[model samples]
Target: MSLLSVLRAELAFGMTPLLDMASISVLEGERIGFIGRNGSGKSSLLAAMAGRLALDGGEVRRRDGLRVVLVEQEPALPLAASLRASLAARGGLRAADLEGDDWRSTARLQEFLQRFDLDGAIDPQQCSGGERKRAALALAFASQADILLLDEPTNHLDLDGIETLENLLIDEQRGQRAAIIITHDRRFLDRVATRIIELDRGALQSYPGNFAAYESRKALAMQSEALERRRFDRFWTQEEAWIRKGVEARRTRNEGRVRRLERLRAQREQRRERLGSVSMGVAPGERSGRMVAELEGVSKSFGVRAIVRDLSLRLMRGDRLALIGPNGAGKSTLLKLILGQIAPDAGTVRGGTRREIAFFDQQREALDPDKTLIETISPGSDWIEIGSSRKHVIAYLGEFLFPPRRTEAPVRTLSGGERNRLLLARLFARPANLLVLDEPTNDLDMETLELLEATLADYEGTLLLVSHDRRFLDNLATQCLVAEGNGLWKEYVGGYSDWLRQRAPPPRAEPTAAAEQDGEDGAGRQARPLAQRAAKLGFNERRELESLPGLIASLEQELAAMQERMARADYHRQGPEQIRSDRARSQQIEVLLEEKLRRWVELDARRPA
Candidate 1:
């Protein structure tokens, strides 16, 4: 049964058309992942479906008495109200109603707040961005709504928060509730979405299953579409040549052919070309000394809280390092210490010679909102130098997906993603041997994010990154410096996934009183599990470690085969029970593989030096 339908939706922004004869029917139990380029009116579409915005033409139909809730990109909460009161108002619960015997509503509210680690009595305005987002989500989930419209729900969330959301949505799919979510988190979509819907050129294209399935089908469809367009153009060109013939040939032209040619001309005029990918490149500066920075027994603290203690690290040239941790984990403080921007309390910080640095701050304080795009990139002069090449400011902005007309527009007029792109455009124009980016993937589209990844992979200079995006870290980081709580940092050999497999689980008991005393004195205690696992493996443990590789490989093979089957165009045509069983088995394999990998790492770490 269809819960909602958008019938021939026609919407426009001023003179530009955002949606043209677009239509889609959202059915029951459907978790749809909505994807598109930045500024493609995805948010507007969600608003229209939720009945918050009226369409210029066409209509939105909803099932009778169906409740729908929308979580905006920047959710607003009453400034004067506490978090609990804000959520209660959203659920339409008055003071008397909450005080009555409504156990279910009260339980639901407590469940979400506890799951999100939010204190209900706190002021909404005092919460951080991620906390605010969680509160908004909690409000939506506690409602009686059957459908949810989420816009960039993962923007400020950390890795753990993203996983929590994924699990919630997957559980929700088992119920009758449905959702239409707009996000750029690829891994989240892979784990949660039951279907994928793309908004391209003001039209909706539906594909069955997750993001991987859509990627495969979209590639083949684009190829076929391109071939057909080429053939059409060829025929159109022949008709144009015949119509341009001299007077004698024109008189002999068939009347039917002439009418058909006129129709083709109109079709060509109305065609909307697809936008191109972002073209990005880095300009390398003069080579620097091999060593970038080195820290010797560094310790930094703020008031009574220790941020970094007894930490030593050497950063070399050409190293791509990622700093991974939750928000407020001292990642920024560590980065500043490495860059020699601040003095350490009790250690030495050394800088490399001949190093030129370019930093992309997450706050984007470098961009002036009052300045035009042209002025921001190249003030006064129209031409800017990129390494050895010189290009006009307008053309440079074009490479970053900004149109010529918007070149003179102020920076404040651009959206969040656009502002990030503009920052990249400015960041890349300068020559630097060291690049430091803080949360660079926060608001980027998938296409732009992938392009940025590729560009960074090809860079010859050193890179120091801080981000909560697991996939981005997995793709680019050569090593990760993870926060191990209490100002202790550990270095993992690979990216975020590697850290997950190698990290020691939390201690089962509280630290000894002596250990706690030492921690308070700036000496953080290592977890007991690491010490317990340091001994040599026994015979049974050795045998188990030896068998892990074969078992892991077999499980991987099985999972790959299942994925290949699921990616087939006719995969959804199978019996519903069979599809469910296969999906269940695939998930089981993933869990088994993670366990095997963790065991292997643990045993290997126990081996003799």
Candidate 2:
């Protein structure tokens, strides 16, 4: 039986339809992902399902005795409560409810804290945004709701927290709990969801399979829609001409034919309206110099607690660096220091000779609430002048999917996602050679996130980004900077996964014969043999390791040449036969590059200290 069903629901704001005649049914034990663009009624739909929002016209039916919990993007918790106390309070379980004399409660709380990396026993009120998210997630999971509705639950979470949540949702031991997750996180969706449902034009439709499948289907659908739109345009243009001729002929019999043409034109307009487009414009800019930004012995501290210490890093043109760490590890602070928002206590910060950097903060707090979209994009110029006599503000707003009517709306009225889009539009409108983004994927739709990824990939500049979106990091980051103990920063040669693999615990060493002899003799005999082994690479492997870098560099140059040749190939002039050959060659090049890159990374990591 279906756990929940929405029948012909209609939700609107003023005269705008947020959702119209949307009906959906979710079965027990189903893991569904709710996806849509920003301001596309995803959150509203979830709210309606959870019965937190009134539906204008529809009925929500739930199975008898089913318990539902809706977790919002920003969870609410009492400010005074400690992390442990808050969890217990929201979980509605007394110490006795847990098995064994309060020990179980304590153990469970400690486990949750440790798993989330909040092991310090800090007050909940003192926790960072990411920590708060973890606490809320712990409480939500403990609730054991039969049906869970999550709206952007991963927004403030770090990579570790996100992984934890994914594991919790996918655990079979959790029983028959179903979930409706509204998220822009493609990776999270891929990991946790079994079904994909898209919200479009106030209606819901299920796409068979997971997030990846949905993306493939969505791309095909978009291409088909584009072709249909072109055909519709041609027909409408021809029919309009015919209707004009009939009206000029002054024939009474032609009146009915003209009316039919008018109806046809209206239908064409509706079809056009259904086609979604985001007008992103990339402004041209001078190429950045070799060095984008540099930091040497950078350190930051507050009240003797050093957040970032002795950090040294360099960003170059065409570099995509992902800054990663647990909450309060000073990932954002590093960005701020680089951007000159905060001054480091000790170190030198430098930028390229012609650097033009743009920073996108986590909250998008740079956007002004008192201003309109048009004003925000072009503050000093008249709308008419900037837009080439048609109001550039409107054009800019339109690029971010903001309607013409909403151009004059106050920024305060915009949703979090809308604000993010607007901020992006503003940033892209201005030329910059270096981009410093802090959590750019937060509040963004999946489509927008993909668009951003593609844009950054194609961008001929430097990018320093901090994001918990694993897919984004995988596709974009060429290097990684992990914040570690005592404000130390470690640079990894490759991406996030590479960092994880390298940081994994090394194999346990077997005790040496001398150590065993010492133990047998009841004396601490020889640390010398163990110390000597640690000081030197095993004699058999030392020479080969020294030559690995040179070998890897040679292979890399060949791979680069192959890539360049493929890029230069003229596929447009190729016949079907040639096209097949060209595709095969491209795939071969890609595989070779991947193989060489992996080998190079492995060789580099094995280098002697």
Candidate 3:
């Protein structure tokens, strides 16, 4: 039996149709992985199923008396209270509210908190964002609802927390529970989901199996769409050519043919809307000296608490370094010290010769919330100067996907992903060599994140970044600086995955000798569980990885064309926006090409040669 069902659902945001004539069903024991681009209505559709939002049309039905729990992306937990107190207040687990056999509920709640790395003794007010989120997750699980709806549950979780969450959701009990998860972490979805559903073009589409299976299927669908569009395009071209010949050619009796051409035009526009090209116009900043920033015995403390202590590191041009650690691990503090916003207590922080830095702070320190999109970019000037050439403000805003109608909208009105894009746009405008970004992926959707990855891929300067998105870090970082909270720092070659392997504890010491001799059963019991925890991938990923090299070469060829164009003497004569836009595209392609190349090599190396 289905846990919930939606039939002929229709939803609209202003004039924008989100879901139209869409039907979806949640079945018992089914773990659905929901995916779509941002604003594709994944969250809204979930809300509809949970009866939190009213649908414009159609019906939603849930099993009578069924309990549903929703864990929001931005957890709405009480602040100003202890984390334990907040959790204990739920599920009738409180000491005062507890009845017979209710102590188990309280114990279960405690276990959840511990698993998420949230100590029950800590105050929610004092906890960092990630800790607060952990507490929220604990609360959601403790509810013991019949169905669970989680939105981006992995966002702020550390690597260990992410793995633990995966284990909990994939275990027998939780695995059979009816639930839907919306996550951009492909790895997480692959591990936890039994099936995949994508919300695309105002419809719900399902694909059996996991993320890899969905990707394989989605690729085939895209190929089909491309072919169909090509066929239509050929037909449309012939009709348009005939129609344009003369007024007599478009006879009154054949008026239907002209209307058909108009319908074809609309269909083409719809297809373009569904699958858009990526254009990241992040200008490659000026080149700096070989060394960009250096930290020598840097120490920082806030009264009794130490954040960074005797930490030493150097940033070199062309270095793509990712800073990773726990919530309060001083990644942001380190970025500040390098930028000279704050001084290190016991060490020297210096920049390389001619180093100009651009910072994309998670808080968006450079943006003026009161300013409109246009004002933020060009201020009062009607034009923005890109390398001494002036480009119209509206045109400049367009490069970052801001439509002309929305150019005057206040920055505060933009969504988090849009704001991040704005931050990147502003950051790229500066001719800087050192780019330091702190938690830039905080609320960005997958598409924006992918675009940012491409832009930074071609970045010719030094990059120091802190992000929780594993995919983002894996795609860009040349090295990783791991901040082991409390001032300990470790540098690992490659990305977060490499660091995880480097940090993994060694295996247990052969059953402690004496215990092994006690009995064969004792040895067997000890060894049984240790042998249970190990794994690998399947066909879709292997196939995708194998195809990356060819894709990479194609991108490189296109990148070379952009580069060749930029090298022409008259390139600058093209409007400054065009010149800069081409350069940004060149950089984006370069980054994407390298990403594919690396992925192909990694996947290839895992096998015979």
Candidate closest to the true structure, highest lDDT: 1
lDDT of 3 at 180: 92
The ten-residue window of minimal lDDT in model 3 covers 528-537
Ordered from best to worst lDDT, the candidate numbers read 1, 3, 2
* Model 3 agreement with the true structure over 452-556: per-residue lDDT tens digits: 887787777888888777767876899998877678787788876667657856556555567656655645555633333222335776788777877877897
Candidate 3: misplaced stretches above 4 Å?
A: 79-81, 88-95, 98-102, 121-127, 172-175, 236-272, 275-278, 387-389, 504-609
Error of 1 at 354 (Å): 1.7
Weakest 10 consecutive residues, lDDT, candidate 1?
A: 520-529
Q: Candidate 2 has what TM-score?
A: 0.74
Q: Looking at candidate 1, what is the lDDT of residue 597? A: 84
lDDT of 2 by residue, 1-609 (tens): 688999999898886687778899888778899998777788888888877899989899998888887878877666433667655656665534443545755576666667666743468777767777777766666565788888888988877788888887888324578889988887677667889999887778798766766765665675677688888778778877876564564578777777777798678654415535565645546787898778899888988889888888888888988988977788887887876678889998887777777778777778889998878888777553321234467765776788899988889999888888888887777678888888888898876877787678777778888999887887689999998778888998777766876775645566677676676344334443333333345554565566656665765666576556655647346554444344334334433445455554554455454
The ten-residue window of minimal lDDT in model 2 covers 382-391
Ranking by TM-score: 1, 3, 2
Between candidates 2 and 3, the TM-score winner = 3
TM-score on alpha carbons, each prediction: 0.84, 0.74, 0.78
Model 1 residue 286 lDDT score = 94
**TM-score, candidate number 3:** 0.78
